[model samples]
Target: MIPEDILFEYNAKIKAFDKDEKIFSENEIARNYYQVLKGAVKMSNFNDDGKEFIQGIFYKEQSFGEPPLFINVPYPANAITLSDSEILILPKERLLDLLTKHHDIHLKITENLAKRLYYKAIIASEISGQEPMHRILRFFDYLKNDVHELTSNSSFKIPYTRQQIADVLGLRVETVIRSIKNLEKKGEVKIISRKVYR
Candidate 1:
């Protein structure tokens, strides 16, 4: 559970977004650190050809935006709402001040950074060697580890569309569709009304 003091401190600054709305854009000045209180956010950026590629996804209860602040750079990616969402925003300076005063918060931040680094390593490895279908499968497996029984028939919801999944997996949209079709053919997974079931 999140610490109540953190919620109390930033409650007044919280913001909401509707699905597909931009929460923040790439190259925007890094001024706030955000904690996802509901729904999901996709972090993405455009390639030279102006095609967007997803960098990561943040689910409910996760925090983001501090890395760019710590690095003293504008935001590296665009943050977009995957669904109607609520996020708590604290000014970067206030967050830094909290870190300075709270040892536990500092440790939590360090652990978050470490987990991000580990995930980055996995993504890099997949980019270098894994096939797109395998990469997507691995990503689903990773999500399942965090969220038990993640299929549509289960309790939790998958908040991404097929095109969004394609972008996040670094595959052409057609490739993503075909991969899912193949998985269906193999009896490995099923897509029903745009929801994935395993």
Candidate 2:
């Protein structure tokens, strides 16, 4: 569990947003970092053609926006709630103060950043291979590692839509749908009432 002192020290507060609401816009100053208390948030960027490509999906209990906070720059991607969500917001000044006072928290932040970098590297490598099925599998593997209870027999509740999944995986929506169908046909996965069970 996260420490209450940390929350207090950072002057954090729980914030709520409705579905399809923008948490932060691209090029907006990174004023605060947010941790999802419930639901999902997607980080995305618009291409020259004005098509949005998802950088990632952050689920409940996961953190986002810290990288830009330390860099003193606008957010590289826009953050939007996938559903109604509760988030804990830690403002920049308070976070810096906490880092100055708590070595352990600083270490934890560094560790989290390192892990994200590692996952990004793996994703980049898979993308270069241009195999949509492999990309989807790799994404599933990452999510399974990050969130507990996601396994062969576990119900993997995907918080994102098919188009969102395709954007995140850098695959065509048709290909993503086909891959999901293949997995279902092989009995490797099942979609029951829109929830995926593996």
Give the range of the ten consecutive residues with the poorest summed lDDT in model 1: 147-156
Please, what are the lDDT tens digits per residue for candidate 2 over residues 47-76? 898778888888776788778898899998
Candidate 2: regions farther than 4 A off: 1-5, 147-155
| Candidate 1 Cα misplacement greater than 4 A, ranges | 1-5, 10-12, 146-158
Work out how many backbone clashes candidate 2 has: 1
For candidate 2, list the clashing residue pairs, or say none: 152-198
lDDT per residue, candidate 1, 1-198, as tens digits? 236467557452768899999988889989887888888888999889988888778887788766888988999898998889998787777777777887888897887777677667777788679988887776666566433435544533345677877877777889878887887788767677878865
Residue 191 deviation, candidate 1, in Å?
Answer: 3.5
User: What are the TM-scores, per candidate, against the unseen true structure?
Assistant: 0.82, 0.85
* All-Cα superposition RMSD per candidate: 3.3, 2.5
Best by TM-score: 2
